[model samples]
Target: MNIEKARFNMIEQQIRPWNVLDKDILDMLIVVKRENYFPQDQKTLAFFDTELPLPDGSKAMSPKLEARIVQELGLKKQESVLLIGAASGYLAALLAHMSSHVTVLETSLALKELAEKNLAADGVRNVSVLLADGLSGQHTGSYDVIVIAGAVEAVPETLKKQLNVGGRLLAIVGRLPVMQAELITRSADAAYDTRSVFDTVVAAAPGAVPSSQFKF
Candidate 1:
């Protein structure tokens, strides 16, 4: 396959059309080499407009969604970031380039090792991968930006507390068929403002608590 051509097509056809217009972000997509994070067998699907399956039963977010999340967060060069559901570390790799430091939380040990290996091979030294349950809300430190790499029924309050004042979070919220991609910003110690950015559905983060169906 013509690698450069395929990559360009992915940006023009999948990512750009999804409203990802930031020149820096579009350029980063070119630099990041999404194929590098894919398993050997799945490398061919790197630029496809679909979620690629990972060894841990989780799925990589589509190229467009990933770009959108990055653009919406509007990260700064000196800010710290926390990424929930690290998966293959592709998103962390992207975040690392634009932030001072990035920490990824994943529950799967195999995935943690895979992420570390991929990030190291790519020379992304600013990111760290942790093997821990993201939904547990037991993390340490505060972050200037938080990105949940997958969908959840709702953004737990515990997770929100980890954000520094003026910090921003991006997540896909709601159930299947449709979900809202929302950006939440912590304006004060206990005040947050949320705005729906778009609508899309992706795989739920593994270990995310499902919303109770039966109302008592």
Candidate 2:
């Protein structure tokens, strides 16, 4: 396959048409070499407009989705990020380039190792991969940005509370047929503002269970 041509097509045909217009983000898509984050068997799917399946039964966000989420967050270089669901660590690597630092939480140990290996191999120094339950919201230090890397039935308040004042969070919320990408901002006085950005669907984030599993 002509790697550079495929990447250009992915940016022009897939990412750009999806409304990911940020030049920095578009450039990062080129710089990051998405294929490097995929396992050997899945490398061919790297530039395709689809989610790559991970070993833990979770899916990585499509390239367009990843770009859109980063563009929507309007990340600044000085901010810190906490990313939930470190599927292969690709998203965290993307986040790292846009922010000062990134801390990624993953429930699967193998995936945590894979993410670390991929990021380290790519020389992504600003990201830290940790084996932790993102749904538990423990050990997730406050940050200026938080990304729930997959779909969820709902955005838990515990995760919302971890946001620093003026921080922003991006999450894909709802059920399988369709889900809305929502951006939440932390305002003063412990308040939050949320607005739906777009609609799409992907696999539920690792560790996210049906709402019925919780007791009242």
Candidate 3:
């Protein structure tokens, strides 16, 4: 199959109808080359809007899901961002284009290294790949934006705390049919506000912190 035609179909048929209308993001998708992030065996299926398998049995979030979250984060050109579950650094690369600085945290050593290599090859200097359990929060400074590549049963408390007063986070919450893609923001009032962006499911990060039984 022709890769360009497939990409155009993905952007037009799958992503665009999902409310990913920003021309810049659409253009970035075209330039970033998703196939480069996929395992060679699966490269031909890169733009199929389906999760691609990883060595650890985990999976990359689908193109549509990625588009939805990227669209929801609404990154700015002069903002520092934190990314959880940096698989192959594709999302981080996308964020690097729109944000000033990005810190990508990944639990898997192999994935972290893979991300670093890909980001460097792409000249995405604004992103740093860190080995850490991103679910619990690893940084101290205020971040203007955060994007979690994997779905979680609940948003970690510290991740919420890490956001600056006006920072925003895009993550998927819940399980199965109840799974919802959400955008959480630390409002100026020092309160968190959340809104569902769409319905989707993605593999939970390998070492994601599980919420307490009481957390909803």
Off by over 4 Å in 3: 209-216
Per-residue lDDT tens digits for candidate 1, residues 1-216, read 888999999999989999999999999999999999997888878989998888777788898988999999998999999998877889999999999999899989888998999999999999989888776778777999998888899898888999999999998999889899999999999999999999998888756777785245
Task: State the local distance difference test value for candidate 2.
Answer: 0.89
| Candidate 1 minimal-lDDT segment of 10 residues | 206-215
Which residue pairs clash in candidate 3? none
Superposition TM-score, candidate 1 onto the true structure: 0.96
Give model 3's TM-score versus the native structure.
0.92
lDDT of 3 by residue, 1-216 (tens): 898999999999999998899988999899888887776788788888788876556788888877777778888899999888878778888888888999988888888888888888777889988888887655555699988787788888788888988899888888766788889989975699999878877777646655664465
Off by over 4 Å in 2: none
What candidate 1 gets wrong by more than 4 Å, as runs, is 213-216
- lDDT for every model? 0.90, 0.89, 0.82
Best first by lDDT, ranked = 1, 2, 3
**1 versus 3: better TM-score goes to:** 1
Q: How far is candidate 2 from the true structure (C-alpha RMSD, Å)?
A: 1.1
